[model samples]
Target: MVQDTRELNRKAVLTALMMSRPASRKWIAEASGISAATVTRAVDQLIAEGIVTETAEIISESRGRRAVELDVVSNRSFVVGVDLGASNVRLVVADLLARPLLALEIATPTATTARELAHWLASTARTSAGDVWDRVEHLCVGLPGAVSQQKRTISNAPNLAQIEAPTFLDDVENAMGRPVGFDNDANYALLGEQHFGAARSASNAAMVTIGSGLGAGLAIDGRILQGDHGLIGEFGQLPVGPLGTRLEHMVTGAGIIRRAAEAGIDLAAPSQLFASDAGPALKALRAHFDQALLIVLTATTVSCDPQTIVLGGGIANSLASTLDRYQAALEQNLRVSPRLAPAELGDFSGAVGAVVAALHKVYADLGIEEEAFVSLPGGDALTHERVQAARR
Candidate 1:
């Protein structure tokens, strides 16, 4: 019990430092709400482990005495992040502080089995990391799927072939020779935006990805909302289209193309169908697309009421011209609606988010849950006290 208490105190001190680095021990104690003696002991242990290090001296605000500053040793270890989308696979190698050292976006392989796909990811990550691969300590994969709470298995992944193969997760970890973590692709995208993109200032936000398929990720009070069954943001399954068709089949890439072909139009891609000077078929397609999106956005607003809803995925940016219409329609229905904005990271949101996921996994060891204020390396650092005060 005493050891557990000490470990908890240590984690609190570490979290305080990570949230606001180059901080004096006095500041860490105040921010963590731990005693000064306990903070000193914890800092000493962290410094010895090479996880935290003493930096330049700073003037103590309370005592007016010079004190040593402490910071997390960000580059001490690395992790590989993977975003497995329907049409492409994105990879990044990042340090403990979630700074990307390498990034790659490539066409997803047409694999017949999960083992083949897993092996491909492993090899690609290693090659992308190159000499830095040796320093990688963990891996996190974000995919268009329903990840189990334990993040050990995946299901409902229409985008990934043979993703349900029993040995797939094991194969990925075994091939990579490191511990692995997983999350829904859209959830990771939301994390990406919150940490580094449009939703950085939004404590409550939703990300809707309209690509080969439709999906959503919700963040409430600066924390990603993972429902009891891990399907909280499964917007693809919502039946909001004509004749009760799934939303996935109404506004998504393949669905739009299929609808266009049925409407006697040959669209090379979904974006082409949204081109200027629309004929009758194109006009009708745009109406349906616009209506479907508005319906989803309105529903999300009523249900989650996020302050901002970031549009993401492959075709999201192309719909920038239609935002006014969606917002106008939503405003008619609700007294207040979320601000609609295009995703800043574009197609790379999920890849960057995967990096955040891996780093959060590392922070979890110190009991540090992710917060919106936890920015990437060299970004703004928010003190723990500030985060708590904001919540209050």
Candidate 2:
């Protein structure tokens, strides 16, 4: 998005190098749509500035010659990803290349209020990140709620109704002295899947996390569709009840249990539900679950036409063996059979998606901005257009 042609050319070349590192100048030019001379100049300038490094000659099979290539220095930069759920919080420290060096989870603050959670987040980050704290240029926190883009405030989180601190985002910044980004957990999971999970190649995909509640994340045309207000994928909030314009009572995992209890059908956690398949609990919920899935799958299919739909979260991961049945039943209602896949990254999708978002901030401008882009691993498949780096 830089206006200057030369600056834009440098950014294009840098992005090309990021996606395909150790790339020759010719490759950089072809991938970035810059003239050979421009690419050469950009690469030369980048190398002279020590922002990019040139590796030893790599043998080129096509040309039958050895050629040196340029690559970003991923090891020098780092980002942190955080996933704060209703009960627990997960933190991951990743290098510029998005490789996780540390990951740990801890219980959330017991107070169950927004201010306490925000304070815990700030203090916990300082403790967990330890020596790597300063190196982390950006921090992305994912949770179950709608976040305002400009303010990074959680106006509404159905599960954590008590959390409503307007300056919570600033609290993290003041605590860490770095840029921070906030987003819903479902969207972060989708970004994680797109970058390193089952949806890596999918241009349009949907991810449904079935845990304490059911939530969804989506990718549209290769970008995370956060909508104008940053809350587009609230599948659990769909109005399925005829009683009023409110969230469907049975659209969540807790809701499922609540509805089942009211109907005199008892159920266990997801693992036990899938254990016998023929177990009475499984049998009892099968019809109801299928009907709800049909509604969800139909909505996702007709609305987004996603090529893949991923299932993840504590419940889904525990009940993964039974996914084929749900996929089969859901496909019965879809116009086209969208490939169903389980989340490869498992429960860590949200945290890793936070990592992906931070890495994206590193990838956006390379060195055009205040903080230079960091080194990241190769095999890139990342998208989230709104993750512009936080300005100082």
Candidate 3:
């Protein structure tokens, strides 16, 4: 019974903390509907546990007293985020504050299986962080496929054909000996943008990743639209032109190579297609790219009606100038043109998103629940000090 009460008090205090920034014991007690005495006790315990800290002394409205403000000690914990792209794997270790302490980007060979890849990532994370691995409470991986709602397995990925079977989350957990979380790379990128980049203030937005494959991650009504099947924004497979010509086939780096080859443009690699020299071959390639962007923009506008579209991935970086050219074509095709912008976080967006998701999950597992500041009746709830003083 005591343990239950303590848990309830902890939950209350945590909820109050989440609703606002660092708060005083009086404020927390009032917001949580707990007694000020109980709030003090809970805060003490949390501080001892390294989860909360006494941040500052706020001048009270009272004549001479000062109130101590408590804040969540976010630095006490850390999380690992990994992004598994078709051609590369990137890993980042960040503190609970989501500050990246270490980052590793390695090429992912097509021949490597999912298990092999997971092991490599776990080992790399362990090596990069050196002695700080023990503080890492969660590991989140963003893959290029549908993740099970159970958050355990990768269902399918056409690009990652080597992963024949579902790569279970337990595999990574076992390898790293830590809790693991999984999400789609595109979805993770969207979360990163919302939390830390261009879409931070945008309520409705879409992130289009133009890489080895083209895909989108969408946010609607302030929440990510993962859909029932967890495949809300698989835009790559969307039929853009002929029945066989998917959006990915028309707009991705791979698509550029295929189109350039068809046009007899001498391009050894997709990256070379955007070389500085604007020879006849490069000029012809640019025209094909402009046409592809028109189709992509039209599809994005019609499907989501987002406030803005953020372009990301390997292709976006190489073709920054081409994006301007595409933007002009996009404006011509769209009935209502949403703002088009390059991704703010660049290639690290996916890893950053994974870190945010991991941190949220870690807080959730610790029984920390966030409560809104406003009550349902549109009134401020009384604090514990007020209630206690009234009782006295």
Structural similarity to truth (TM-score) of each candidate: 0.88, 0.84, 0.82
User: What 10-residue stretch in candidate 3 is worst by lDDT?
Assistant: 373-382
lDDT of 1: 0.78
Question: Candidate 1: where is the Cα deviation over 4 Å?
Answer: 59-65, 150-153, 367-392
Best by lDDT: 1
Ranked by TM-score, the better of candidates 2 and 3 is 2
Question: lDDT per model, in order?
Answer: 0.78, 0.70, 0.72
Per-residue accuracy of model 2 over 1-392 as CA lDDT, tens digit each: 43487787777777777767679988888877889999998888777766688887788778688778777776677888888888778777777766566777787775656556667787877777778777778889987777778556775576666555676667666766788888888888888887777887788898888777667887777577776566676766777655652343554567666766766766664344445645565666656665666677667766677888888877667656766776776666553567778888776779878887877776664644322222233253222221211101
Candidate 1: 10-residue stretch with minimal lDDT? 383-392
What is the per-residue lDDT of model 3 for residues 1-392, given as tens digits with 9 covering 90 to 100?
Answer: 99999988987787677557578999998887899999998888888888888988999888968998888776688888888888887777777656567766788767766687667777877886778888889888888877666545565477886543655466677888887877788888877777666676677888888888777788776566765455667766666656677767877777787887788776777777677786887877776676766676676667677887788988777766666666666666664577777777777778777877787777776667633211110111111122122221
What would the TM-score be for candidate 2 when compared with the true structure? 0.84
Candidate 1: residue pairs that collide:
none
What RMSD does model 3 have?
A: 8.9
Better of 1 and 3 by TM-score: 1
